[model samples]
Target: ARPRVGYYYTGKTGGTLFNEHMKKLTVQEFQSIPVVINDSASVYDAICTMFLEDVGTLFVVKQDSILIGIVSRKDLLRASMGKQDLESVPVSIIMTRMPNITTCKQEDPILEVAHKLISKQIDGVPVVRERTVNDQTVHEVIGRITKTNITKAFVHLAKDELHD
Candidate 1:
């Protein structure tokens, strides 16, 4: 094939093709099991869980894993500095509650999830599924999407591409 003087074909480089394939991927394809804590749990318990699980964030849930809020390591540290007893302070008091939390669904595009993480300045977002509880829409924490997960996905894609 020869290029005509005035002809142009849309250029598609490996980067462009990679971007397209990445966009088609979904959160569920790379999400990790969500580390969770009960909303009723104390701040002390949340800290313990964070260390025990080696996770920076914890999805706060209520009955049947219904998501209500999220707690981070910083939240626990701040609470620990308060005059109040850590064991007496519920995680709900220190968590970022619903209507304030960022979330994603299993079917959401991976590209969108990555953008949310970057724009929100958060390490992770809960991967949830919607449910009707008492006629109210609620989210159930099923998984989590983190920067590490996205990096792993990118590495895996690149590795596979190299082999191809």
Candidate 2:
């Protein structure tokens, strides 16, 4: 059966809320989980894993899970072409620092996120949260949201609406 259009509108409206009422509607509802690496991990390893995972970017995090930097496929490829020794070089040496990284929260509006992706020319955003656990600082990684996910969600919602 064809999907219902009103259902899609209702879903979109519900997904647009940025406050506590914003429910986790789908994988698109949350930021994409940042693919991460350690500071000491080899650049070659980082590149290989990212390719295996089929992701374009990876986040470099400390042992404590504090976000440190990001590395993109382009960055890795560029580094590979340079004098840098991928097997010996650490990800920290090639990563883009935190000052340049863009992130989002789980409660953020999906539409706003879509705009950010377009304006920033980024494929995805990392979802993060800060919380205290046992009197220590902790970062909680919730999930990942991507442009493909958004498009698929839109199409599914549209089809569902047409049927209704």
Q: lDDT of all the models against the reference?
A: 0.90, 0.72
Candidate RMSDs in order: 3.5, 7.0
Error of 1 at 25 (Å): 2.1
Q: After aligning candidate 2 to the native by TM-score, how far in Å is the CA of 55 from where it should be? A: 1.0
- 107-152, model 2: which lDDT tens digit per residue? 6666666778899988776676777878965565555567876786
Off by over 4 Å in 2: 1-33, 132-139
Q: Write the per-residue lDDT of candidate 1 for residues 1-164, one digit (tens) a residue.
A: 65878765668886888788777789989999999998889999999999999999999999899999999888889888889999988899889999799999999988898899999899889999999988999999999998988898888788877887
Query: Residue 121's C-alpha lDDT in candidate 2?
Result: 88
How many residue-pair clashes does candidate 2 contain? 19
Error of 2 at 11 (Å): 19
Q: For candidate 1, list the clashing residue pairs, or say none.
A: none
Displacement of the residue 15 alpha carbon in candidate 1, Å = 4.0
